[model samples]
Target: MFISFEGIDGSGKSTQARLLAEMLRLQGHDVVLTREPGGSPGAEEIRRLVLEGDPDRWSAETEILLFTAARRDHMERTVLPALAAGKIVITDRFADSTRMYQGLSRGDLRGIVDQLHGLMIGREPDLTFVIDMDPAKGLARAKGRNGHEERFEDFGEGLQSRMREGFLALAREFSGRCRVVDGDRAPEVVAEEIAEIARKSLAWTQKA
Candidate 1:
């Protein structure tokens, strides 16, 4: 199973991803936990350049392309092989972040992102869990984690709102494969809800 967890920064994606992987492992299932833009060495380098550098160094198109570059590498080097080996892959963030960040946040680059996504991930996630949260709440948690904010995370209210809307749009567009979970709840509660959803989805897939 290839499952992805997505949401705005500080939406508890990483925490829930780890928890889901752990639960799957405890069930004697082989599982791999990873994240986008930094899953592989090459992708990690791209991540640093994209997230840590001066904002002006890259245009919206450049950002979309770089993100796609990293994603291509990550898919080739990590995601595909694991799935072929029968290991469940749980990713903290995936192509949706690129669409939301560079496409929606930056505007005018969604076509570029969509083309890259089709080229890279020919098949979308078997199941995508979108952890939805308020922008202010999510950003506050994100800032607390780093004691500072990265360039993308520093977009404040306007951009954050757009990003959240973008996520919802993607979820609606792929409703059959995407499930939005209320992330405003406690972390443990969210994890439990996600696990149940994953369990049910896995069963449904097998029967199909």
Candidate 2:
């Protein structure tokens, strides 16, 4: 099974993703927990370029291509091999990030993003957990972190709010594979809910 966690930065999706991976591991599942735009080595190098520097370091178009390249490398080197080994792959972010950041955030480049994804990286997670939360709270949580990856977080609350809406719209558009989990509650409570969903998804997949 391949799963992804999505939402505005600091929605605690990353934490939830780790928790879920650990839970699955403890349950004796062969699980791979990873993140993008940096899973494989080649992708990690690209990640530094895209996640740091000035907001205008690269034009929106250039950034999209870079992300696509990284994703392709990740799929070829890391994700595919693990899936072939029958491991449960849980990623912190995926192509959906580009759809929101480059396609929806910057402008109406969603067509380009989708076309690129279809052409180069044509796979979606079996399940995507969107940790929905208030933009203000999410931004506050993001601001508490210090990292070179602050580029997207630096986009500030307005962009994050729009991003939240975009993700929700996407969840609706791909309702079969996306689930929205309210993230304002305690982490333990949120994790429990996600675990339940994960259990059901695992069972369903096994039956199929």
Residue 137 local lDDT, model 1: 90
Off by over 4 Å in 2: none
Residue clash pairs of candidate 1? none
Clashing pairs in 2: none
Cα lDDT tens digits, model 1, 1-208, are 9999999988888889999999989988899898888798899889888887555668888888898988888888999999999889998888888888888787678888898789766767889999999999988888777732277776676777888888999999989889999999988899899999999988887798
**Model 1 — which ten-residue stretch has the worst lDDT?**
147-156
lDDT tens digits by residue: candidate 2, 1-208 = 9999999988999999999998999999999999999999999999999999787788889989999999999999999999999999999999999999999898899999999999999999999999999999999998888777888888789999999999999999999999999999999999999999999999999999
| TM-score, predicted candidate 1 vs. hidden true structure | 0.95
Q: Give candidate 1 regions above 4 Å deviation.
A: 147-149
Q: Which candidate gets the maximum lDDT versus the true structure?
A: 2
> What TM-score do all the candidates reach, one by one?
0.95, 0.98
lDDT value for model 1? 0.86
Global lDDT scores for all candidate models: 0.86, 0.95
Error of 2 at 167 (Å): 0.4
